[model samples]
Target: MSARPEAADQSRGSAFRGEGLRKIYRTGETEVEALRGVDLDVAQGEMLVLLGPSGSGKSTLLNIVGGLDRPTEGRLFYRETELTGMKEDEMTRFRRQNVGFIFQFYNLIPSLTAEENVQLVTDIAADPMDAREALEMVGLGDRAHHYPAQLSGGEQQRVAVARAVAKRPGVLLCDEPTGALDSQTGIRVLETLVRANRELGTTVIIITHNVGIGAVADRVFHFLDGQIARIEKNDHPIQPVEITW
Candidate 1:
């Protein structure tokens, strides 16, 4: 059963809305406050970058937004759909319908060919581009028949990008997407993400430790002590190729 998105409240003009978001992890008597009452409104089609040190709550917030984890306290909405209030099954459907996530690792099956790996996503999506088309979009059309072991690290990551975008998701969530790649390869991956954002109008949110990566985003949020310390908006953002790290 493919998940189809409900009619969205496009008039809101926001991809995600958060109010008083907080996440606390407890083990026995010890407790860790990962987030502290965070509030935010991410505009539709905007590219946002989250930057912070470890334990600063960047990944925790990303996980909550992507439906991988629930916040201990707060409200989160996708357009008009209230995510925090949804049942687990509802959240699963919502995520499948509207969100695409990319992680630091490629996560491709070793035995599958590049096209086969991407096909796994298209098979379940309500509406998806052809696996070959997705591969071409990431400049891997010529290597679609190759297995993961036959591809280079950068090529493997590109295939992962193809798989995520093939679903035509409304939002793309990437956590340390380019952390495992070298500078040149990282730029290529960023370029592909930018192309997807522009072509598909997907709201892009990326979490990365590289401050240089922020140059490509429309806004950058710096997190500290479980809160957003600062937000910098770029009126004229540079391209990924122009970034120096």
Candidate 2:
């Protein structure tokens, strides 16, 4: 594993700021609380890892921060714009313009080739990288014409990463991005993410159950029972290849 030098201007601004964040879901007669008062500040160009077991509220918080869901209570700000009070259309626009999401499932269109899948996003973005360029960033320049079914698990995930980043979003939110892959494949995905953060200066927040993955992050947040239990900062973040399950 290798360590990259920290960005000299990484601490210049805030990417996200949240205060008293909360989420609640009610189905029939049951009420479930997914997040409980999460207050967080993610610096621009920093890599943050959220570690917790199932039902720990990390995923819920990620969803809200990424503009996929609304918080039941609390305020969230992307830079200086408040997200908590935005309408559905406003949130949609915010997500489209500022956030990139990567999930455990690849979510690639089966009928679209690798480059075409990435093009789908770039087509709508105001300022996007060329689809081929995005694929090249993830080491998939040669697989541009391949369909999802023709790619390996890791390759498919890389294609998904290319699609998410083609728009050059300011923030990248990942939810258990390597949950379905083997250790070696997972490491490859992590390497791609690290490279993206370093080169594009995107603020990244990742949710994972694997503790070893935390070593690559600038800060690791431990979640327990719907709240942040603690946060640990790594002065010298390592590479994904050094992480062990």
Best by lDDT: 1
lDDT of each: 0.91, 0.90
- Predict model 2's lDDT versus the native: 0.90
RMSD of each: 5.7, 4.6
| Superposition TM-score, candidate 2 onto the true structure | 0.94
* TM-scores for every predicted model: 0.95, 0.94
Off by over 4 Å in 1: 1-12
Tens digit of per-residue lDDT, candidate 2, span 129-236:
999999999999999999999999999999999999999999999999999999999999999999989999998899998999999999988888888888888999
Question: Predicted candidate 2: what Cα RMSD to the true structure?
Answer: 4.6
